[model samples]
Target: MSTSDWLFLILQFFAFSFLAIGGAMTVASDMHRVIVDDMGLLSNNEFVTAIALGKISPGPNVMFVAVLGYQVGGLFGALVLTLAIILPSTTLAYYVAKWGQFNQHRKWVVAIKAGFTPIVVGLLFSTGWIIVDGFHSMKAWILGTLVMLLVWRTRVHLLILIGLGAILGMLGIV
Candidate 1:
């Protein structure tokens, strides 16, 4: 990539870093928007599959952006995507932590923390819908429901559920 291209990618990285409110979900959605919507780097199905793989992988799901970048523009793209997804959060977190400490006993701070609980839950539900909407069929619904129940009812490892889903997928059961 040229210097201009690198600069542009860096700017995009800053934009994503600043805009994402939550953690991985926010970064992942930002990546989806850039790669799928803006760049047209991958098809919708590919985008979803990439995200699923990212989630099941050992590390953070946001690393999927690097994979997409490598596919689209090799090493430079991967570097740009990583910088964009992570840098802002790391920098802002410092300020946020300081602010939280400064306002530790403030009533308004307490109220805001209380308010954020439901907002976070709502975002998580929306993320779930985004994932579930990609699956097409009654069977997918049945399996998803069973997995959801298992997650809710037991302390089962999430990887186990994800593995079962993958196996079912491979068997064409979903």
Candidate 2:
């Protein structure tokens, strides 16, 4: 990639880092737009696979940025995008945590927390919907719905659910 391409990649991730309210997943649709739709850096399948890989990994979901970077460039791209996406958000989270602790009893703080709860929930729902939309099979839809129901109504461990999903995938059931 050229210097300008590298700069744009870094800047785009940096901007998305700040917009990642609730979580990095919250900005996924915008990331899809910029990386796949606008820049054509990755195709639809590539983008969806990146997200799936990131979600299955042990670290933060923001790892999708690293996957995108690697897809666009290489190792350097991965490192640059990961750092760009993390730095601003990590710093802001630290200071905000301090502020929140100090102002825990304030009415505005409580109100802000209350207001953000629904927004975060909605963002999470949207993220799930986006992922689900990528699956083209009715079997996948049924399995996903069953998994969602299990998560909402039962006390089963999440890793077990994930394992079950993986098994289904391996058996070509979903």
Error of 1 at 156 (Å): 2.0
Model 1, runs deviating above 4 Å:
22-56
Q: lDDT tens digits, residues 1-174, model 1?
A: 467755766787788778777565566666667767886767778777767677777787677777766766789877877777788888888898889889989998888888899998998877776677677678877887787788889999998888887898899888
lDDT of 2 by residue, 52-127 (tens): 8998898888888789879988898788888998999999999998999899999999999988998889877887
Model 1 lDDT at residue 37: 87
Over 4 Å off in model 2, which ranges?
2-5, 25-49, 133-138
Taking all chains together, each candidate's TM-score versus the true structure is: 0.76, 0.72
Clashing pairs in 1: 13-84
Q: Which residue pairs in candidate 2 collide?
A: none
